[model samples]
Target: MYQYSPFDRQFVQLRAQQFRDQLERWERGELTDEQLLPLRLQNGWYVQRYAPMARIAVPYGEISSEQLRMLAHIAREYDRPDQALLDSAQQTQDVLQASQPGLTLAAPPLKYGYGHFTTRTNVQFNWIPLSKAADVMDLLASVGMHGIQTSGNAIRNITCEALEGIAPDGIVDTRPFAEIMRQWSTLHPEFAFLPRKFKIAFNGSEEDRAATGWYDIGVQAVKNDAGELGFAVKVGGGMGRTPIIGSVVREFLPWNQLLNYTEAVIRAYNLYGRRDNKYKARIKIIVKAEGQQFIDQIEAEYRAIVEQDGAPHTISQAELDRVQASFVVPPLAAANLPSKTDTQSKPYQRWLAQNVRAHQRPELRVVTLSFKRVGWAPGDADADTLDALAQLADTFSAGEARLTHEQNLALPWVHASDLPALYEQAKALGLVQPNIGLLTDMIACPGGDFCALANARAIPIAAALTELYQDIDEVTDLGPIDLHISGCINSCGHHHSGHIGILGVDKDGKEWYQITLGGSDGSALSGAALPGKVVGPSFSAAEVPGVVEAVLTTYRDLRTSQAEHFVDTLRRVGHDPFKAAANGARLDAGHRTRQAAETASA
Candidate 1:
């Protein structure tokens, strides 16, 4: 993890103070609500359906145990509890009112709850008060973290592989470059106000874990002809009302020129991007409208900057060394590891199969502590959970943890010998779902329940689907699946990239769901050059579960073998089969309704 320098700490502190002043001015009516809107957005504050929400960025998804503890503190102090507590007397009174007078409740009051993790690799507190926003900012800055530029028409957090430094097949450790961009882009006065929000992602590993193909500016680390390290730059990728896979702009760009090249690209977009319509203001729209001409303009601008001064294009060797040094993995003692088959516990075996991944170091492993539990929202965690995780990190994972774009936590450096103990601890914390890549492991956004912009509720649909797939054996039989749900067309859940994507929409003032099949985050890299397409007409929310089950059943019956993943099979056969399956399920549901009505009449 990159430690904050004195300058960095002071800068964050000053930003917090500025926000405090702005908040005071707004409270005093000196600044209108409209005036405070942009300011609050720049600071990652949003006026949601219920209350103000603050999104705290976790840069590159890396954090120390101390930082987790601080976040836990904020959750306890500022955020609303997930469940309201009742005193013993109140509980008894409620029971008596319910006509269950004999029922006695626990005496102790439960601890307060807090925030939820986001798919963007950040934490969001949805019920924050506007008055406490400044205090939240100060608390975050105190721990060298901030929500600056997390929202607004500026470059958002630069995301990368969660296991950046430890991926075995990675071409380069991407954290250094990600951190460099983070520092450079933070509060860049020139690009502060673009046509729309910009997102940049880098992927260093052979596996594209960061969904690079769906970002505004996506870079894949690759080796050039001379075996020199560089990036393969792709621009225009995004998802929303219009989802687009980014086009390749540069086959190879030297590592040193990354900053200059990115700056040039964004500058061109800033100059040429559409601003008249907020809906179409994204860079992807510009790319679509201009085609090759867009790339030509960017190249021309990049050349001009390069010719003007080589200084800005060059990253000093010393600076690179310093950033690289900050990410050094801690030493681990050699322990004779237990054999994989030694554990007869089915839960342990299931956990190992799902949550564990091979690490760069042979003796160490990466464990994904899943947050996708049944009945609970997929990505939510209370203050107590965060604190528990911090303790686990300190004891077993070198006091460091990484948050994943999949809305889960990653312990990046646990020894093989520590697996049993860690697994036990995780089970106690209710973090051992053993469904990392299964059907129940769905990604969903806080839809109508929290966000003001949502068309319908998303979390309930996600929960229903998760419950539908509760039989782990049946889910295992169904094989690897990526299910994603979004409240609206914003695609915050990356629904466009899931093998089975569900988008909540409003039809005649009723909630409906549109389903798409064959989407995968790795599709572009895996030779499928297109995003997922819709299967059929949007269905009512009540029909979603059966429709989804039918789609999975279609895959199971049609796939050549179990080894064929859902996306691969769907792509090979096209969406016709899944569409037919969904249609059949809908028809059956209608027939059942008619039969039930006829029986009631009789």
Candidate 2:
């Protein structure tokens, strides 16, 4: 649980009071909604289709237990107070309500309600009324917390692998680095107002759990010649209107110079990044527009910044040591459980293979709580399930909970012996699905349902595809593959990075989708495929699985059996066959189709 500093606390109260006064003026018919909107939004407030929803930037997915309890407390007060069960929307609203403070606004004029939940390290909430926003800010300040640079053109959040400290295989514990960056970037005067939002991610795992490549600046934990821990810095990657993987600028970087390097990169972006073209606004475009070679030269220009000035790096080594000390690993007993009778049970072995990870210490195991069960939504976790997971973390995993970027939970430090009982409890709560990297563990965003920008619904499409892959055991046996679905051109679901990506489109109000293949998830990427025309939803569902099957079938025959796999075979033969399967014939070559097209047109 992260404790906020007094400065952080006061900042929260100040922002809340500011918004509260703005709300009062709007209600008195003195301000237009458009004029009042941005002012209200500066402090995590937004008016949505149904009601207002607030988004707080949760830098590094680090929230205190007290803060979480406060979130639950706020929700219970909002809707169904007597029932003790607030509906999802209303609950989210209360958590999002901007903290209110000094502003003299009539609290009675505003009826406030809010709720809190994490969606990819961003704290999302259905927000309360604007009038009482100040009081909420006061409460948050008392707890040593505030919401700054959570929105607008600023450093949104510094994210890391959710299992940072818990996972044994991770290269470094990212919490220290995350906290350092968080403090460094919080309201940095010069870099505060940029052309657009900026996000950073850090990961040490080989699995790329932090989605390193999909950030403005992604830092992956790596070791140099000295065998000391540091990060391989990646620059200019992002998602949304334009998608590109952050290219690695440095093969190796020393640990102490992280903040310095980060400042240089941001400063470079601040100076050269586009202000003219909003579509081409991100640092990715700057990297692309300036050319990677030229970008490298520009980075060289800022070597002085890295060596000397910019981002004075407020946090020191001793400070970093103190911060690292704060993240206390859960205390687990030394005894190991008997492997047989425990892991050998029916679902036990499967669960162990899929959900469990070894810890840095020998006696404990890290449990990856998968959200993808057969019937339920992929990332959906009910209150009971959440509470149950919290209890399991306390029981088997040294009383600690880790939230993953994949929108799942991790009960780190679980004893191997206790896995059977823990599995049973989790299965009852619908959290124990023995699939971690399989196709069913797909990343699909809330498309048309919750997001106003969505062109088509992505959730149902992903679920249907999951069902298809489930229906075919052969396809399921094709090893791990990423199937991501985004509802619109923005690619909010990260479809570009998926091995097989689906982007839903609206063609005259009917649902349609386009498929893109070979796009990678990690840093080095396979470029996006040429998407086919808008195929209606009817063909989308039926043809999607069929295309996958056809591709697999071709892979089996053309391959040196299953050992060659899908990606390797695709790399060898190219996308002609897949295009033929998804689209129709006449796609071979001009020599073969030379006469055919003339006759069709004639």
Candidate 3:
């Protein structure tokens, strides 16, 4: 984790103070909603259906135990219960349930406040009041965290592989580069606003866990034939009404040129990206429109910028050394295997198999803490849970934890011998789920329940599917599946990259779901794949669980063996079979409805 220097602390405090003044002015009626909208948005504040929502950034998904504790304290202290707020929450939850009949109610047992993790690996508090928003920002700054650039048409959080430093097959630890980008892009005057919001992701690992291809900019750390480290820059990738896989603009860019090249790309987009129509405003749109010409323009601009005396290339060696030193891996316990008596329990074995991974160091391991328990919304943790997890991290993983782009937490350096004890502690906190890569371990967005942009309810749909596959044996039998849901086309849930993608859509005034099959983010053995293709007509939310079940059943029947994952089978069999199966399920449901109606009439 990168420690904040005194200068870094000063910068954050200055931003917080400025926001406080702006908020005060707004409260005093010095600014209208239109005038205040962009200001609040850039600071990650939004006025939602019932209350205001505040997004707190967790940079590269790394947080110290102290920072986690601060978040817990913020959840408990700042968010007090209000009857009106509760009523609004209930109303939203009701709408979610209406779309998905027979779904379990998703209202968690609340105290003062709740925090939900987002696909960007950030946490959002939905009940934040306008007056309290600035206070929350101040609290965050006190702990070297802030929500700046988390929203609006600016470069949002600079994300990278959560397992960057520790993944066994990782080519290079990209966290240092990611942190450098974050510092440079934050409040950059040139890109303070843009045609639309931009996102950037980096991955050094062989497996693309960071969804690099679906970001506005994707940087893959690579080593040249001479063994010198550099980057492969991909641009124009994003998802929304238009989904695209980023094109490789540069096959190999020297590591020293990272910042200058990034600036050049954004500068080109800022000058020519669509501004009149928000719908077609992403850099991906412009990249598509211009094709090779766009890359040519960026290359020209990059060369010109590199010629400047105080260009991005001026970053000092001393600064690089300082930043790298902050991320040095801590010493680990001596190697020791756990005794059979400690690991023989069935539940322990299952959890270890699902949530734990081999570390590069034999004495250590990486453990994923699952947040996908039944009855709770995916990616949600209460204040107490966060507090307890923070304490556990301090004791078990050297006072730090990492949040994955998949919306799960990772204890990156748990000793191999500490497995049983850590599992027990995590289980007590309900963070142990033996389905890390299975059907129930699905990725979902807040959807209609909380998001103003959502057309349908994603949370309840995810909950219903989890309940439908309560049998662990059934989920495991289904094999590894990536099921992702997004409430709308913004693709916050990265649905386009999932094996089975569910997107919520508006059919007239009703909530309906559109299913896409045979899509993946290129994790297949072949290294070639396609984005999900929509099946047939959209189905109602109530029909989603059954439709999903039908699709899974089709996969199971068609797969040659359990080893053939859902995406591979879908590729082999194509979407026709899954579409037919979903259509069949819909027909059966219609027949059942008619039969019941006829019997009642008789």
Candidate 4:
């Protein structure tokens, strides 16, 4: 469903008539909120403490059933999950009911999950205002969509593997090289102002699932040696407050010099990276201060700007067959299998054996739609369950929807007999609770309520430790937990690869936490042990799930049973009894198991 080009309809209708004449000169004050705040942040707007948020740009996490009915028509005409936005880093205090003292707490609707960080493809408008934010950018540029470069420091949103090109175990078809690096990095008039936001990913599986060692520039799609198809790249990956990964500097790279080797690795970090540290200006800290043969001789002088054929629109095999014929896929009429009555046939085959995934077309089905359900709020999801997942993507997807960088939500194709009516409309929009890939399916980030840089309050410490693991049969009876959370160190809540990690800090401001062990993502054993760091503010937020059940009761007393899970019992007991169970001392010995379950079942 990726149509639109005549240069993407004249750069989104001339950037929506130049943001409708800068929204009529910022409503007649002759345009000034710091000169229309970078022209309403290049049309994604923002000014939100309660109003004006506007986001819109869904580039790689595709969409369309007419852009999910224009985002359920802009959150049913200007949002209302109780009109939140007072710097929404997800604060609480609103819950009231005493006979509707003008009811305000979270209404059973308008939850709004489906939002991953900026790698293009957005949808965040929390209560917009400011003269109707350019009539919502002229109704998202009449549906083709806009919200250019998503945020400042340009070139974000080129992510891949939202089951890219229907992954039946992919190796290439990263949605036509993620739409030729999203049309050669949209808004590219000399890489449009860069020094911070860059992110790029491609990973055509062997199961890297596009975390591609956290990105800045990470690819993988291999083949070469005349089997043609190229790229292995991986230059200096990222995540905030220093989280490196990406290293390999091109183990293949042939396919038509993939845009002159990514414009010679972003013009060697746009003429030698680092612009006086705004958080060590990422190009992955200029490829960790230029090593690896000086960034492979600066990508061999940008692959000699693609062997002198010049870089202006280079990766063309007829523009990857006209953007892979607008992502082909669209032919699935011949239904009539509906009859899953046995309590929907064993949780629909155990939630499709943990959220489906086998499409390269064979009657499709890639699905995911998880949002880590423990005790809720892993990634919220409300607003008539996001317009009933936009009308269940027009009856069990193919009308398309995709979004996930672990925040989960993707119906890439679906058809295995409409996976039991999309698992009863995603369990009535509590979004299929299989706890995909496990560890309560986490990946926290919006730490301290509306982060202006957090220090505690990563959503009530990830909702008081998912209500201390609120017994969903003891979280699938403890299996694949990855649980992450961040408030500081800007890892946006990836709290460093979580096998069971959590971090939040600020002793003076009152609140502190840290823990790590056997972290992961993929490509078989990534990494994370960290450990050393833990302070307290009465270790608040209901003592973080009893300090993660005292590091799962010192991983069930150094596992030898319960068939080891918590990252294989924190890799066979290390880190000083999982750092004395996240530093609060064996949570008073598992709270003396509330008097030994009433003295061993009496």
Candidate 5:
């Protein structure tokens, strides 16, 4: 919720105009594709399988109602693919499905006119025309939003925990620091074109809701024994072709020297980080290969930056105060009133239990509006939904909402007394599913359906599972489970951190999925940050839902109590039973396919 200064506003507008000129030149053939490529990428434009995609940064996941409305406008007006293009894309998908017969793939028709909420808290548009890219950028700039540095091998958007300021167990609100870092790194000439794309995340709470361990740089706010504010800086953590937990470089870096320390870390990586191969370009590779040497190099870089460079980036207390001012809790009419949850409706009770979380202010609550539902890709919101969300934010959440890393919207300012009314409105908008961390609340990416890099379609598998798990009681009984699906090894869906991870893979030109078990995002439910282990060979698209069901069934049977979560039960008992269940389901699916084939022949 950091307010853009006059300079910030002017800068964004100029950048948008600059992009418009670049786009016009490219259209006129004045610039080659090679020339326009980096320009467009730096502006967050990417040519995907079917159309151009735009990634708009929502810094630290904070977005205003006005910005949300602008996004809704962009989705409705600009995010459209040509009819012929849509038809061709659909044909390609149909052919892919036909290639694998006897598979019950839930190939929903490709969709547009919506925005996808990403794990990094950025919003993506799948079918925006390259021609309108400039126009979209202009509109975003008008609302203090832009796609700058959202792509390319630059430091991407800085992210923080959605509950940063309001989490009961928060050590310090990391938003101000994250914002400061964002401003410094936005267009830093030295690090703009690093060896590879870099991501940074911050978490202030006792729990790791931001998945900081899965980022290039993970910063956690901490205090020294003397109670002075600082940060616990971890470097080299990332997920993709390689999954590695970040190593703690500096256990306690003074808050004032955050930027100086961050510069040291990246500067060291820039000097020695691999550039010859994109595969090993991530800082994790350098850290993994060199270990202590890498840490020592960062230390040496820090010394040089401090001693030789004079630590030019040290934060001033006044600047910190200015940034913190924007994040203060908005004055609420019901702040002094006690929460009244006397409504006895079962649905309301369920929603309260699942979607509503305790706030730092006892009179308020943090409510998560579920985007995971049947017949839609998870985290996708059409124009109408986006507009409605904006209205909801205005009416109930002090005109602000935080986009969660899990691809949902968290209204952090919802009054405890307004829960019932808010629930009713959200339900009418189809955003009131009582499934926050449940199995149905899975995270998935726009897989082969849109992403050219995907090995298989992720949407169909997510759809199949969502359709299969419509029973709320069954989902709640199964308990909190992180079921993440990724189309490829990009880890866009953060599958490596799920308790049950499904990754789309290619086998002999047909779509197959690899199932992984026992991953964690280092949250209270999921202990420690680690990638899930693959149970067995990849299963066909048809077997995924059944395979997942089989695993859940095994979990239900083996769990000592309902309180025992999926990850916990899996760890206590072991992966053999879950692995057997998954393989058995695959065998059953094969038998069904054979039976259907015989019947067709007859």
Candidate 6:
């Protein structure tokens, strides 16, 4: 993990104090709600459906145990909704359930005192009181963490591959470059407020684990023919109402000129990106509408920036070395020999095969702690869980953990020999679920329950599916499936990229879900990155589990063999059979609902 320099420490502390002053002013009526809106947003405070939600940035997904502990502290001390507020919220939800006939509302009661790991490698708190926001910020700054640039129509948290420095197949460690970009973009006055939120991702490996194709700007580390390091810059990729894969603006941009080239791209977008309508403000819209003209504009802007601007932002070798030094691997102590009994255990073997991954060093391993278990929302960690994770990191991972883009934590420094001990500890903490890429390891957002923009709740659907697939044998037999759920078209859960995407929708005041098939996040398993195709009309909420079961059953039956994956099987055999299976399940569920209603009446 990158150590915070004195300046970095001072900067965050000062920023926290400034926010406190701003907040105080707002409370005193010196600033109106409209006046405080942008200020609060830049500080990562959002007024959600019922309370303030705070998003804390974890740059490039690198986090230290100390930071994790601070986050835990924040969750424990401040992330609480009043009892009255909770009751009122529950009443509203109950009313909603009553309004929708035949739809089973299994959503758990509202929760707080927890942090949610987001797909962008940030942590979110849903029920933090607005009055204590400053105090939380101060605590975060004490641990070299903050919510800067986490929200607003500006460059959000810069993300990289979770296995950036440790991946066995990594070409170049993109962490140093990503950190440099993060520093440059934070509080950048020139592009503070773009037409819409812009996201950038860095992928250094041969595989796109960072989902670069779904970002506003995707920077893939590449080596030119001459063996010089550079980047393959892709722009205008995003997932929302308009899902478009990024276009390669520059096939090879010199590594030194990364900042310069990036500025040009954003500059071009800022000048022409839509502002009148929020829906079409994303860079993808401009890219889609203009096509070659957008590319030409970026190129022209780049030329001017380099030739006329003297390429002021070019990365210097000394600067690169300074940033790279912080990412040096920690010295490892000699590891204890594994116990024969532990190594022979089937549970240990299953965990090794599922949650543990190969590291660059043969003596090391990257272990993912599963947060997608039964009875909890995906990516959610309570205060106790967060504190325990910190202790685990301190014990086995050189005090560092990486927040993965898949909403999980990765112990990147776990020694190969320490796997058994770490597994035992994590299992005791309920973090050792052997389902890393299985169907139950799904990604979902805090839907209508927390987000005002959502049309329906996502947690109940996720919980139902998780319960349905609790059998590890069944899940493992199903193979690696990317099941993603979102509450709305915003795609916060990255539903557009899931192999089986479940999007919550509203139809005539009732909750419905639309199922899509064959999407990919650009992984080896998921082939080229593309949005999933919708199978049919949205189904009632009660029918979602059956609908999914039908799709998976169809997959199992039609697949060439057990070795065939769901997405591959879907592509091999057209969507007709699976679509029909889903619709049939919906019909069956409706019939069951009608029968139960009639019985009750009788």
Query: What TM-score does model 1 achieve against the real structure?
Result: 0.92
Q: In candidate 4, what are the lDDT values of residues 1-602, reduced to their tens digit?
A: 67776777777878888888987977888877898887777666766433456676776677867766766666666554343443242333232112112111222222443333332336565556667666767777787888877767877667776777677777777777777777777877767877767878787766776677777777888886678878788877776667777787888977667767777777777787777887888887777777786587766877677567566556668878878898777665534446444544656666777778778879777778776554455655544556677677777775778877666778876777667767776777767767676666777765544445667656555655655565656677676677788878877666666676677777665655666566665544443223222332235443566667777777767778776676766666666776765766536634655566578898
TM-scores for all candidates: the values are 0.92, 0.79, 0.95, 0.33, 0.98, 0.98
lDDT of 3 by residue, 545-601 (tens): 889999999988999998988877887878899999999988876776678778889
Q: By summed lDDT, which 10 consecutive residues of candidate 3 come out lowest?
A: 102-111
How far residue 270's Cα lies from its native spot in candidate 4, in Å, is 16
lDDT of 1 by residue, 1-602 (tens): 78778988999999999999999999999999999998999999998765688999998899889989988898888775333322442453234224311112211222235667888888888767899999999989999988998999999978887988799888898889998988898889867999999999988987777888888999899997789999999899999999998899999999999999998899889889888999899998889989998899999888888997654757878999988887777655433333434366888898999899999989899999999876567788888889999998887788889998888999988988888888878888889888888888889998765678888667767767777777888888777888999989998888898888999888886667899887768733334435678989998766788899899999999899988878878878988988999999888777776787788899
Candidate 5 runs further than 4 Å off: 103-105, 334-342
Ten residues in sequence with the least summed lDDT for candidate 1: 100-109
Model 6: colliding residue pairs: none
- For 288-318, candidate 6 gives per-residue lDDT tens digits of 9999998899889989998998999999999
* Candidate 5 backbone collisions, by pair: none
**Cα-lDDT of candidate 3:** 0.83
lDDT of candidate model 6 versus the reference: 0.90
> Each candidate: RMSD to true structure?
5.3, 9.7, 2.3, 24.8, 1.9, 1.4
Candidate 5 residue lDDT tens string, 1-602: 78888999999999999999999999999999999999999989999999999999999999999999999999999998899999999999889888766556456788889999998899999999998999999999999999999999999999998999899999999999999888899889978899999999999987888888888899988889999989888899988889899888889999999998889888888988788999999999999999999899889988998999998999999999998986767656542333344469888899999999999989889999999967789999999999999998988898999999888999999878888778878888889999999998999999999999999989988988888889998988898999999999998888899999999888987789999999988888898899999999999888888899999999999999988989999999999999999999999999999999899999
Please report the TM-score between candidate 6 and the true structure: 0.98
